[model samples]
Target: MATGIPRTKWQSAPHHIQPNGLNSGNTDVHLSYEGKKPELEILNTPPANLRQLWPSNAGHVTPNRLYYGDNLPILAALAQDGSVRGHVRVVYIDPPYATRSVFQSRNQTDAYMDLLEGAHYLEFLRERLILLRALLADDGSIYVHLDDNMVFLVKAVMDEVFGRANFRNWITRKKCNPKNYTRKTFGNVADYILFYTKTENYVWHRPVEPRTEARAAKEYQYVEPGTGRRYKKVPVHAPGVRNGETGKPWRGKNPPPGKHWQYPPRVLDEMDARGEIYWSPTGNPRRKIYFDQSQGVPVQDIWLEYRDAHNQNIEVSGYPTEKNPAMLQRIIEASSNPGDLVLDCFSGSGTTLNMASHTGRRWIGMDNSREAISATLRRFAKGLEPMGNFASKLESAEREEESEDTLSLFGPEETAKPSPAKTDRHHAITDFALIAQEPGADDLADAVGQWLEWKGESRIMQFREETVPYKTGKPQKLHRAKRRKQRR
Candidate 1:
């Protein structure tokens, strides 16, 4: 797994390359795996089948899609399809941490299990990463959430799957407030998210943090007259000596020693003419920066804000390991634009999906756990208001259909076409599709596939009426009982 460039060689170079940071310099260093060929061959094999069960009646309201099943095969199916392959703009996955613990909902419903250990777990995640990489557009980016348990391993896998050159940031996120561990270790309160892009030219809308009161007071101490707006005066010169027009005389004044003008001489003259330049009492010239005109401060990698929801009032989904919506919103906003597709394969409580829908971004979500699916459905249902008492009307319509079915079974005469029940329920925003059993290539059309249409600014997907239960096998009992027994 060693790279072409030796550590000593890189150390002898100018910059100090951090181990956790991006390897930004020199293309000579490349991550190589001895078993890369076999892994690639295994990943290239397509899913056995891509069978679609039914369209979620709820899914049609928005361009979002929810798939129920393992993400590996679902991603493979997406790769096989023409419309979705190389079309996704953003991907955010918060996979199980291999903690070897069983997770349950607040009501003791079995959520998911994280039992795989060591290499097996690594390979399990690597296979999906391979397909995810193929599914991304050239400008797409991915953020993989992980704990300290396996962040380094996954980082290596990501570097190999996605070229090392595409590595972006190792963002450290403060997951919770604090932890008081009984064992001999420090409190674990943080997790890491590895961010990478598919190619050099990637979608990036720089994120910003709101200006704090203290920061605003310190940076913008000056007040402008007539308007009384907060302002700051910054030197018009920058580091590095230059011989260009920026280093030349401005109004017969030369640049300071070992510094060059931030702008050209003509530009400085124009700023002075427009009253943008502040002439100090000591004859020093600086540029005026207004507080309201600033776009806030640029966001950094080490995030202290946007912690996870700890209490009932703070958390919306109550799904175990559910992420904060604001965090997801930031990732979506920074990495994608309106109408672009966002993907969350391990969508637990649909936090990413909810954020994507609210922000006008199309999304696709997949999960194998039945509890996860139910949570997501309930979340979306509450968030979406049906037109009128449409729920009651739909129930009534369904009851009538049942009655008609009974009548048709008893009569031998030809059955008439049932009239379409129409309400103001016009445009749909989301579509739900299920991949039951693995089908062959011939079943592509019959399988669940989503088709989208735009109504003004909102895009809707056509949903078919169908439901296929997820096959998650037997549910595990909660560990609460065991802990209670031990207390006795």
Candidate 2:
């Protein structure tokens, strides 16, 4: 009999019942459920039949790809593709949260159905995650966005797949404004993102935000008498006793109990001589940190600024559940650098792909929903309208009165005027190939046709035949159609 603590139904199940041969020795705990497929079975999913609708521009090697298909087979195909497998540097997915509701675009078009629940949804996500893991490079990173509905359960599944040691951060984001709930529960305005790395060594560019004047004044209250520089004082001692020179006393003063000098005795003496150390009225020493020397405040896990479109002033793709572009920008900038491959299998509004492209990263986006594909295509072709407040703010800043005699900490400020604001509203998307998973699929063709009609174009580009190699089964032939050129 199991003692000490009672196990839940999932935890009490036999070790052999779980897929992937998960056991106590390998994984700490597993979420056992009926109809769970083995990892091998999931990874062996049939590769998608692929055909390119539009070829990339000349001299553009490794062009971006957009796929219209079920992401499971698409991911599997990518995992087997020589150029993509083990080459993806970043993956950001905002999958359906098993809300059991039908989502539609702002124009009343059906986007997708999130009907899966219980063990079925878990299995569905796990299958895709396995393939995503296979596509990740050794130093790659992934961020999974979800809400409270199924984030906890998925967290467990991710731990099993990505290994517990690779888990980085459980970031919380304020998704929307506060809601006045009629129910007993508190207002639901936040969601979560689970960040994980493929290995111990992963690419990371630390994200920082500009320090606001209010925050700077509050944090750096002290002003130097001679230099007029804003600064703050921090403790010169840190926790934990040491046996090195830092543990020894300097200037006849020892480190406090259970503490050690942050610097060596000689280093502290040099800093004191250079006036980098501050002496308190009571004679306590602290190191001075200047505000002008700081790059910025390091961003924290709880994000409150990058909220979703709430008011009419915010510009969006009209896709239901579209994420903030700024939020995606931060994630892409932090995880990957220029020319890195970024993958988003559940690319709803193509926000991740757009941000990746804007940041000079290669991107691949896949989605099965016709509405989603259409929205993404429209976003790429005709850029979203600039945010109402953003444009107005820029104009106002540019119109600010320029003064030549403005005083500064050092001396009078120079008479340099702010640069003119860029008013171009469209994003010039790099050339990318639009792929259809099945040859002559009516749904995909219809989506593309709708997009062309919306853009006032009559000609339809023909799809070029291509075969995606598979481990098992013969390659299927893709449908070929004649291209129709637009009338001049």
* TM-scores, all models, native as reference: 0.71, 0.81
Worst 10 residues of 2 by lDDT: 412-421
Residue pairs in collision within model 2: none
In candidate 1, position 168 carries an lDDT of 99
What 10-residue stretch in candidate 1 is worst by lDDT? 479-488
lDDT of 1 by residue, 116-216 (tens): 87777887888889889988999999999999998988888899889888999999987754433326876566799999999999999999876877789
RMSD of 1: 17.2
Q: For model 2, what is the error of residue 207's alpha carbon versus the real structure, in angstroms, after optimal superposition?
A: 0.8
Superposed model 1: Cα runs more than 4 Å off: 1-39, 56-63, 179-186, 383-430, 437-488
Superposed by TM-score, candidate 1 places the C-alpha of residue 149 at a distance from the truth, in angstroms, of 1.6
Q: Which stretches of candidate 2 lie over 4 Å from their true place?
A: 1-27, 56-61, 310-312, 385-424, 450-488
Q: Listing every candidate in turn, what is its Cα RMSD in Å to the true structure after a full C-alpha superposition?
A: 17.2, 10.8
